[model samples]
Target: MTAQAVIQVFILVLILAGGILAVWLRDLLAAVIALAGASLLVSLEFYILQAPDVAIAEAGIGAALTTAIYVIALRRTRRKEKE
Candidate 1:
């Protein structure tokens, strides 16, 4: 396969791993961080796919704003899992 394809595949793998970690982690903050990582990776993938607008939106909203909101909410709550 081509180098670009390989890179895309690698990014996809990272995104999948991040999603799994976000679900599996017991710590809420850690989970959020993982989700943000996934979002950032998705934005990067979008950019690589020639969709700069979507990439910027995803990076700004999904990675930055969403993470900020989550962190702010997290600050007012517990960080550990209950189970």
Candidate 2:
């Protein structure tokens, strides 16, 4: 198998594991982090698959923006939980 294929497989496992962890996790912040990790793995897979456009979109929009949104949401939850 090619190097890219190996990377793709490895990243696929990461994505799957992250997804399962996100679902099974009890902590909201940890779930958010796991989801972000899955998104990053998706971005890596896109890069290995040689789709630069998809890679860029996944890295920029899916990973970064989504992670930022989740972080904000987590912060809000923390504030609410504290109150």
Instruction: Indicate which candidate wins on TM-score.
Output: 1
CA lDDT, candidate 2, residue 6 = 83
**lDDT scores in order:** 0.98, 0.83
> How far is 25's C-alpha from truth in model 1 (Å)?
0.3
What global local distance difference test value does model 1 have?
Answer: 0.98
Best by lDDT: 1
Model 1 weakest 10-residue run by lDDT: 73-82
* TM-score of candidate 2 against the unseen true structure: 0.83
lDDT tens digits by residue: candidate 2, 1-83: 98877877888998999999988877778888899889988988888778989999999988889889888877766622232
Clash-forming residue pairs, model 1: none
The residue-by-residue lDDT of candidate 1 on 1-83, one tens digit each, is 99999999999999999999999999999999999999999999999999999999999999999999999999999999799
